[model samples]
Target: MADPVAITAPTTVLIKVIHCIVGIMTAPLPHPTGLAYHRMGHCTGRHRWWRPLLGTLLFLGAYLVLSLVLFALSYGVGAAAGLRELPDGGHDFGPLANTALDLTSIAIALPLILLAVWWPGRRPPGTLSSVDGRLRWRWLARCLLAAVLPVAVLAVTAALLPDSGSDSGEFGAWVGWRSFLTSLAVLAVLVPVQAAAEEYVFRGWLTQAVGAFVRSPWFAVLPQAPLFAAAHGWGTTWGFLGLLVFGVVAGWLTIRTGGLEAAVALHVLNNLLGFGVAAAVVDGLSSDETAADSPWQLALADVATTLLYAALVLWLARRHQPRRLASPVASSPAPAPAPATTGRTVGHHGESGQDR
Candidate 1:
């Protein structure tokens, strides 16, 4: 969904504050190690089989309630006011709308996830972000930068191919500068948040959920792949396979890097480009088509580009060696300050003496 996220000083400040919290949270763990990102829920060494199960339930119930409240507030109280949603008893969405609304719906999950972890899961909320118990913003930024190229490559490859999926031979008419720009504007804000939220839920929460029970990273990684694909709804066989591959690859990278940054980076860029392209053409955003709708050729292209992106990110990880485990190796204590030089010479008896 493409609900408009206002570009405001408050939002900017809020983001900065969040990054600041990461460092603060990561400051105290002593010898926090031998844990992968998937096992973060067990970071406190208090893993019950039912903790994540309960957190899941809490997240779902809260999500449903919050979604309703948000809809009511946005559509009922705001510009979409007075529009009746229910003919009989169902909720109305026509008043408030789609993409944006949908985006807003998913975006809220990111925060609620932390809450669920902190409360029901009985762990620090930051663990949901990484094994370090917080986001490593610098690492995330590097991944984000590394992510852009492959998505662009995918885009160019798609453009190079025939329009196998389009009904008409031509791409649709221009959406006009105003509409096009508006869509980009809104998408720019929403895509990153929505994509990151998915990573938190699937790669972060789901992986940790399973990892808490198992020792193998493969066990933690595989189950969420199908679920992630299923979340998009089955589109075509090839497309479904593509999404599955995407999920598996992304999950693996999340564990490999010890956080969700790589996954989130790729997802954010992929979605932003996809949405930007759709918004460029008439009725594009209105089209319900998603990554799940790709043809076999496009799906193949996606696989190639995605793999390439993963390789690139892994290479970057090697060079930078950002912590991919429970806690970064702590810095050694600063050497104690050198003793101040006394002007007097020390005696062989180890006493300070007057100049010899």
Candidate 2:
């Protein structure tokens, strides 16, 4: 017989390897007190200086490659289906098809952001969602309710007030109920995903990416704002300024309330309202005028309304007291030098069931 000791040695090695892999998979996330939304990335134990940087490269590559593929596929399909390319409709697609394509393109970032956190970043992805580890759905629902009324009021008020500077679309003949309802249904489903992805990219990932290096939330929040504005494409001066201000406000709210809930609530509602308006009228969706195309009056009112909405959210936050800072997971205080934080950590497999 082969020597028993030799046989046992190989088996022992296999066991040790299995154990090490398991340990990494289940390793607890750092639990740090006073971990703000921006600083959540720095709270993980696995954080090396290079992880976030590498992850960013991966993110850009993956997103660009996939997005190109998606658009090419969409273009091919649209052509097959007799969809009109602009100036008739979406770029190489029908209006509705192109709008769905755009919304879906933005939506993909949400998953990619989570993946970056899990692999190269080597932490629980939940930390990026909020201080509480996962998205606070209850809090998000409440915020959604809070935003609806003000946004509705403002949208109606703007419509009633005559269009200034001539860019806001004319209230043309109502598209038949079929066109309006179909567009509404599509917007309702995809708009929230699109909005949430943007929030995750700007408010969630960008802020925390910077916060991983800098402790200050303002420093973390400020950088993403301009990028957010630029992403919308420069239009009039007022419109660009409006986007910048909106970005700043959204970023601030993400930090102030300890999660993306408030920002997402605002974004989803705002997009739905805006898109709904475009859908309601003749060929309105065909016009590519975004929030970035707002004239001065609309831009100023948009900013003011955002601030007012922020104020209302702040009042609600005070009353509800959503957890803003990371709390330690271990019985003893988490080590000061730990790399990452939140109610949970990024796992290779799935999220910690505890925090959710």
Q: What is each predicted model's overall lDDT from 0 to 1?
A: 0.81, 0.84
Model 1, range 132-211, lDDT digits (tens) per residue?
A: 67788998899888888899899999989877854433547897898888778888888899999899999988899998
Best by lDDT: 2
Off by over 4 Å in 2: 1-28, 81-92, 165-171, 331-356
lDDT of 2 by residue, 1-356 (tens): 79999989999999999987666545555654558899887667666878878988999999999998887787677778876675533355556766888889999998998899888887777878788778899999989988987797769767767657565447478999999999999999999999999998899888988888998889999999999999999888999998999999999999999999999999999999999988998877767788888888888888888888898899999999898887765444333432445555534333443422
| Model 2: per-residue Cα lDDT at residue 111 | 94
For model 2, state the Cα shift of residue 318 in Å.
0.9
User: Candidate 1, 244: how far from true, in Å?
Assistant: 0.5
TM-scores, each model vs. reference: 0.78, 0.83
